[model samples]
Target: DPKVDVLGLPDWVKFIFLDIGLASIVFTCILGQLTTQVNASHMMIDFINNYFAVFTLYTAMTIEFIGIMHCAYLIKNILSAVSGKPILSNEPPKTGFTFAFYWVRVLMSCAILSFCVAVVFTALLAGDTAVSVKYPSISPPLAVVLLLFFMGVVGTLEAMQIAFFSVAKLPPSQRGTNWFGSKTCSLLFDGNGKNLPTFMIGRQLTVVCSFFLVGSFTSLTIVPGTGNNIFGVSDTSQAFLNYGFQGAVMTTILASIMWQYAASAFPVTFLNSLISFILLIVALCLEGTGICGACWV
Candidate 1:
């Protein structure tokens, strides 16, 4: 049976209208900032400088969206467990709304993948000079390597979505025959709990890595006093730290409240907040000490 919320609206409606709409708004705001900066400066240096900052912001936004989705899924599982109601079964789309929603998700995934590829190509064509000059601490080769790693992280996240959708689109018999299809099914359902622990561990690790990677870059390149930017005295590090920590704390508090209402248990919500704090500290340390091989001098 298809999932419907209390208001009788299908799950697809919420996912399409709410989740995608929010992501689009976030992207548009960031993109607008980049566009404004670019339009204000005709020099190549200024353009490249703004590009790096915008790119880092984009990466952080992507991480935030992914984290929110994963957290929502976790809460859904918790609700299902507490209520002793099985999750809605995964079946091929039948209704027009469901079919349109499925295709929209697929197309968005493809668009993201294409955008990632384009960015990678642009970075490569921009060459070592652009990267090295913008991030003067690291050697050109190492800077390029780091940029590629950032791109890879974003690409991999979206690629996983596309892979899952692809697998879901296949016939049940055909899904088992395909490696990604079979693995996706196992990871998605994880009825035996065999992969859930590993999945959560890996996801948390990715979140930490992404936070540090993007944070370190933005700290040096986008932080107003630190970098050669027109935006005066803006501290990207502090801003990111505030955003990350606040987001985690708020999400945890909300989730805990929901859990309390549903299960009548006041569970601790400090884990995610603590993780966010620690990750920010580590990133700040790396940024301050230049221990991550990025000396701004």
Candidate 2:
């Protein structure tokens, strides 16, 4: 999105996905080495299962961070719009500006962030606290539940707040093209009669489902991992293999994200970040399942 072309971003930030990919490479190697050193003759199976497990579990965080950055593109556009401004050339906003002028914008952004964190944390703590009584360990299932709770509560609110506020503040002329677009924004911000809760529930369900699908795929790999397999790849190899897939996913996902950013900038950018993100999701699922099947059956 034209919004994504912020000029001031360090080259490193722009290429973070590759960096993440490289880190996964290093992580895989280290994990494999550690497994070999520890398990000696019997390490292969353990390594395979563990390798996949690490990447699968870590995927949650990885996807989430990328998604959040993905959100930044929309945010920048909506934000610059709010300021009655348009980015001249994807240049990064000047730094060292007197906070006195931009504090409201800065504060608004920070408050939204704080609320997102607080709500997610509270929901997680609540779920963990609640689940502990029945399920002792922090199992994968419980983790998913916690994540669902986070998204269901915090994710919707975060999206709503940004979407509405941005949509609301803009002139009717620019507030999305739809006749109802501005109306919807006003409704969202006004906390319309029970509409907010209903919309929130829908959004919550959607996000929770997204997590569940990903979690289900990840669980297939990890849950079986605790079991024994004679010829299963060691956890280390599994992690590296999984890491390789994740690295690939991140690379594609990153490209998609950057494309999405560029697309947001002017009008037409022949790219979509979501395409690769979706592909990455599928690749991880296939690779994760492959490892599981290889070892389990």
Candidate 3:
């Protein structure tokens, strides 16, 4: 029983607090949301129907990324144990690539925040007539504004916490006795303090690329009866046989290949990039020419 206390907390304490209590609370909240119909309409149901496939695809990709990272972590630990080398390292990255990626990530985050703000303003100004009709008592603009405000507040707080605690490099004196700063920094960087932001950026890129690729493909195929073939194709089977889907698939594949390089802390050399691009083009040509269906979108 003493040996089983991994975090210096009893097993029963963990089970009670985490497994039962926290899980029950989460379940209750979800149940409440389902019962109440948060949007007071079939909007939630519609959203699920329309976007659930893409969500599942993104979730699956993210899980795979996590699993890969976990495996790498396990292998590193195993090698460290065998060789008697410490897992932790105090060395900084030799290249400026990590800092460059970090700045790019910051810019991307700012762009996304700006886009969200624009969407909020557009929603406030455009005022959905259906939403207005659903809730006759409440002003549509007011409701939209209030919803956006609440979301903005929560997002801002979360972003601030991530920026300050996870990304920011605090001095040793400011890190405190508990070493929370070090733990946070470790989450963003590896043991050798390399790729400070690529891991996070790679994750985001994976999810976004997966979403666009899978979402576009599914949207074309997963429709009532026949399918939504905007390409004026005669056959529904070839509904996704279009430039858009090809582009999405290619983009996803390129991102995935680049992510591999980023994860390995290798700079994206022009020679390698050219080779990758040529190989992808050949693969796409083969798929397009009906020679192989391996890269089917």
Candidate 4:
């Protein structure tokens, strides 16, 4: 009765996720209002700049954590349901962990490792210290760890996709009368698909980031003596700065649209990456031409 089928999550679980997402929206609204107030008051540029970036990063990470938790639940239920494994129905709590719990733990561990790597890179690359300062001790290990963690996550997703597709491919002869229930396949493959719980959260994260970007520009415009201080955009040259702003806006629009509709995660990820690559190139060109120093930050 508890089999997962195409709906990888229970109704109650879905409701919980909805609540988390709603809560994040509320948080964003509060922060956005605060940002507006700060700008109106003409707060110190240094403080506003730092606060905005840190707040955006924190919100993104917070929503990402929520998404990862949702993903863990969906993955556990789907794997258990499809594999005909015993659900976590029990009379009392046990000291021993179940198979589903182990898998969830593994996924969480990988996520944590990746998070650490991200933190190291962010600190080293974007900290107040000059870029010349080398983090030689941490950089290499961080790269290696991230590479391994990424491989694990990708491999697991690939395995799950393969399993679901194989089940989908089962013929009527293989199954009793009908092919493996079409509903399950549709649930996993159609619309948003079970493979992209994170993308759902990402949609909101993008909106929050976009709002912050807009707020940053607004703060710079309204506050005296803040031009180019926040984003390091050139006061003299507007070409690269304009391109970066446009790119951010377009990225946010794309993300918002995906939030409304059910787009497959794979393509969304690809598009985001492509957009980011182009932005990075623009940033590099700007820096190379001495127009600005990391205006895209």
Best by TM-score: 1
Candidates sorted by lDDT, best first:
1, 2, 3, 4
Stretches > 4 Å off in candidate 4: 1-124, 128-233, 236-297
TM-score between candidate 4 and the true structure? 0.19
- Give the CA lDDT, 0 to 100, for residue 192 in model 3: 64
Ranking by TM-score: 1, 2, 3, 4
Whole-model lDDT per candidate = 0.40, 0.39, 0.37, 0.37
Worst 10 residues of 4 by lDDT: 215-224
Error of 2 at 275 (Å): 16
User: Between 1 and 4, whose lDDT is larger?
Assistant: 1
- List TM-score per model, in order: 0.28, 0.27, 0.25, 0.19
N/CA/C clash count, model 2: 24
Show the colliding residue pairs in model 4. none
lDDT (tens digit, per residue) of candidate 2 on 1-297: 223654666657645523223333323423533234335436656655766658866986685543433434445666467555576677556467543434444454445444444433343344422233334466545655654543333333333433433444546455445434444534443444344433433333333334333332222122225543112546664444333233223222222333333333421111112322232233334334332121212
Candidate 1 off by > 4 Å: 1-137, 161-171, 176-193, 221-227, 230-297
Q: Give the 10-residue window scoring lowest on summed lDDT in candidate 2.
A: 267-276
lDDT of candidate 3 over 211-250, digit per residue (tens): 3323222222223235433333355434333223433332
Worst 10 residues of 1 by lDDT: 263-272
The per-residue C-alpha lDDT of model 1 at residue 62 equals: 86
Expressed as tens digits, the lDDT of each residue in 82-153 for candidate 4 is: 555555665564345655564565576446444433433333343311111222333443533443343333
Judging by lDDT, tell me the better candidate of 1 and 2. Answer: 1
